[model samples]
Target: MKKKKIAICHYRVGGTDGVSLEIEKRKQILEKHGCEVKLIAGSRSKGADYAIDELEWDQGVVPIIKENGFVYFNRKDLEDDELKRKMNKISDRILNKLDEIQRIEKFDAVLIHNIFSFGSHLAAAKPFAKWVEKHKLPCIATHHDFYWERNEFDIVRNEYVRNYMKKFMPPKSKYIEHITINSLARRELKKRFNIDSYILPDIFNFNQKPWKKDSFNKDPLKELKIKSTDIIVLQATRVLPRKGVELAMDFTKTLQKKIDELKSKKLYNGKKINADPNVILLIAGYTEDMDHDYLLKIKAKAFDDKIHIKFISNVIKANRAYRQRIKIYSLWDIYVHADIVTFPSIWEGWGNQFIEAIFAKKPIVVFEYPVFKEDIKREGYNIISLGDELETLENGLHKAPQENIQKAVQKSIRWLIDKNLNKKLEENFAIGKKYHGYKILEDFLVKKLGL
Candidate 1:
């Protein structure tokens, strides 16, 4: 079969976000299997084929989206006439760029990522639908998340907004294939739009070399102002409300107490545990997408509890880069220093961080969110499980039981000291690779595209 020339389109790519990460991996696998993958996104980055300023989620469409009253919860009263005009104006500009690229590239299929699923940019989605409809473009719509699944988008109550969503979100086409990141999302898409979608779980490169604490990243703990004896518990998810990051703080507190109590005990490896081990919760992701008050509240909570939590996302990126001669570590650098990965998310598309933790060969503490219980937990990897139910306080803070946290600490210690640590890590790696690795993705794409 001839190599398919494919264009991957999304609002943003080349970031540490789940969708962007998945695109990078997909592009690698597609290129490896004799497909030419052109990346088309709003933001300019290294691997992009086209990066138009106007296509950005925050910038070019800002005024247009604000006029449509889509980005905020307390939106201004709708002016339908003006909103339509602005939408079309932006839509035409975006379409012009896309058409120019299509003419030159002659892509066999355009894989639209998240633009149709996320409701933040209906102007782009509507124009995309119209263009594809008119030109009869073969396309695949891969969704990391849906707008309806997010509570933030519920504020779009205007009739005009509703009409736009109903008409253009995930444009219907005979030549388009729909893909969802999880089974629950696939089911919901079918229920809401009567649209069937293939369940494509997020993928990782399990065959790649393991990330180690190299000379470049050996002293991040020192940089974080953490003692050598401190135990690093990493919350690798973004600081979002649904991420249940407060639960991670709570778990840290509980684990710290247990560690103190058992400080005198010697491990099987003949190492004495520190009585005052500073349990540092290193959060390593950007918080720009979250509400400002949410970050403030989390910081305030950590301070009140006297928890050693560091928001080190500023120093972390998708890949290692240098800023002013100072080292900007990759997410893998943080993972190398992590003693245990805490994934206390109440919801996830397919839990990219969870898969990442597995790839890092670290013990994980995961909250049994709905999708995990329905799709992931059954696969049976060894993890400290926080059950589905959460107790919410009056202040909207969430918590798991102290017992679960203690159990996690005990399990983490055991894993750390076990003589057969490599054996256990190898077993987990095998399971992760079988379920969520690049080889699986390669086969799926090869079959799907008849490559």
Candidate 2:
């Protein structure tokens, strides 16, 4: 039998972001199952044969979306005619480009990531939806997060915006298969839009050997001016408000106090430990998509709290490479060097960093976000909890309790010093491999695609 040709489409691919990482995994699984896979996106990549400039979620689409008025509070604010005109221009452009791709590759199936759910790039939605429907394309729309779930999209008042969001943002048709990363998203889609979707949790490559301090990465902390004695708690997410990075800062401050108390009592190799290790919160992800303002606010909070946060996004890239002056490190390198991983997100479509921490066999401090509480907690993997509740400030930044922060700090100390805890960490690896492993995704895709 001939293999099916699958095209994976997204705003961008081959990046460190969760959606890009998930797309890479999906492509691997499908290829392993005898499917010929192709990459398509807005970004330029050596792997993508069909890259379109306008398909990106960028300034080009911003005007159209603003005209559509989905983020406005009143219908009167929407210039539907202008919105339609702008969207039509981009739609026609995309449709023509897609036609060229169709002629060249003739993909048997299309896998779209986040286009429907993000609700950005309103311009691409109309023509892309029309093309897919008219061609009766076999598409699986994998929704990571919905616009409705975000506060920014709450002001959708214009009927045109609402209708366009409902219809084309991800057109619901019998030919299209919908999938959500978590069960909560599936429930919400069904409740709100009468749309049913398959629940496919995000996966990790558990079969691979655990991340170790390789020669290439062994001196990363030293290179970054992070002392060997420093207890590095890494916040390996992008700088964004919803990420609740302020919580990590609060945790670091509390953890610093706890470490100060522990320094007097902590013993190493049956002797008193003398070295003073600073508690450093290292941020490894970049601030893109209008997060510069959020980054400034986090810096101010970190300064006020006297917390040390090293922004190392410039040295980190989607993939490891030698740049002009310094060498870029993969996200995995940072994980390999981390003494502790902090995932204090107030919201997530799915927690990519959480699973990555698990894969690395590192002790983690987790904020029990809604998806984590509802879909993930039942498995009962041991992690230092930041509790389920958050205090939102007037500025909308979230803070974890000082008590929860202290608890996680103590747990991390134990994880770092106690040789006995190795057994527990090993058990965590076993559980992670069982549930979130690549084999699970491979098997799921095989069954779903009947490959």
Candidate 3:
């Protein structure tokens, strides 16, 4: 096939958010398969064929989101004129940039990510969806999760904007090859609007060589006050109720008791258990809900229950930049140090944590969110499963060593474990590359857009 110029649009790609990481991986794979790419968003991109500044609405502050360590860029607070103006300015710039792209290059297609599926649609995403509705330009909306899944948005009008945010999209979206991250999302898309989408779970660059954690990652940990010897049990998901962060605490607590039991018996053959655990659960990242006072209260209560949890959102703000001003580090830094990852999300669009755990070659304990069953679970992911109650946990953990995961723990510890989701990782590797990778996208272009 001849080369094609593809421009991707969405929110910022600088951080370790699921969207950012997926787009980055997609770009690398697409480039390998021969496609010129560029970026457009409120955030600048070092990875682009041409970078355009659409608007900085997402870059501004929403008093509510700010208190919760989040920014509502495209979601203007509306009460503030300056913020509103900034948002308008960014939206206008995005349209203008689209016009410019059309004028300059072949601009074969614009792979829109998450823009039409959430309030974060700032740049070319919203209007792009509208434009694609008219088939103005060949495009696709690769949704990790949809806006309707969020509980807060019940009564919304702006049909264009609302449809853009939720899985309940208009018939026009169907013309654009709807792409989802998990099977649950695909089924929901079908059930709600009869729209079928391709599944593109979050992916990592498994083909490329990885670098060792160096001074940049080291500095963030130093400031985080995390000890090198401490086993890092990370809840590497967004701070939301569905994420089930307390489960991470509960598991750590369980492990603590086992550790203590092991110590008391002085047996290392998985025979004796320890009474006290030296494990640490790091609750990292910002919660979008500023009014999460209830969440705060609950978190405090969890702490009181002896779950050694650490909040490192501010420390790892956006990236591992040492501007000497902020103590930001990439989420990858934590993944690099994880002894185990806890992702007990009630729901996930595609699941970035699953991708991270596999690529980093670590163990993970996750809930069987319906998406797991629908999307990648069957491919092979032998993870420690957690039912609603704590009863199933012991059985899950007791077989940790024999439990076959995609990769083994590099640490010296060994025990019987479950090997349920190991193959899911490889499936993830191939599917992610196909669904989001350049090759699959090329097929989508021909089949759906007829480009």
lDDT score at residue 225, model 2, on the 0-100 scale: 86
TM-score of 2: 0.93
Highest lDDT scorer: 1
lDDT of 1 by residue, 204-227 (tens): 999899988788999888987888
Give lDDT tens digits, candidate 2, residues 1-451. Answer: 8998888888788778888889999998898778999888886443575788888776665544653566443334436686666667787998888878877887777888887778666666666667677677778888997877876677764676678777876678876799998988998899888898998888999888767767777777888887766777899998888888888888888778877655644432232434586888999988875678889889989888899889999888877778896788999988976777889898998889999988887777889999999988887788888898877788767777677877777776676677566566677888878888998878877766668
User: How far out, in Å, is residue 18 in model 2?
Assistant: 0.6
Question: After TM-score superposition, what is the CA distance of residue 420 in candidate 2 from its true location, in Å?
Answer: 2.1
- lDDT, candidate 3, 1-451, per-residue tens: 6787777776666555678777776666556657777776554554455555543333443232222211322353344444335444555666666676667875777777776566433223445655554435667678775756865444443333344334324234544666887767778778877677777566555555543577667554456775554556788876766676656666666665445333434222122323443667887766765427536854775667787678877766445665567656777777776666787776677677776766665566776667776766666654666643322232122122222221222121232222433354455455444443445544544565344
- Candidate lDDT (C-alpha), each: 0.80, 0.79, 0.57
Clash number by candidate, in order: 0, 0, 36
lDDT, residue 242, model 3:
64
The TM-score ranking, best first, is 2, 1, 3
All candidates' TM-scores? 0.92, 0.93, 0.70
The reply for model 3, stretches above 4 Å from the true place, is: 1-3, 44-94, 104-106, 119-126, 133-135, 157-175, 210-224, 262-277, 289-295, 313-330, 388-451
Which candidate do you rate higher for TM-score, 1 or 2?
2
Q: Return the top candidate by TM-score.
A: 2
Extract clashing residue pairs from model 2: none
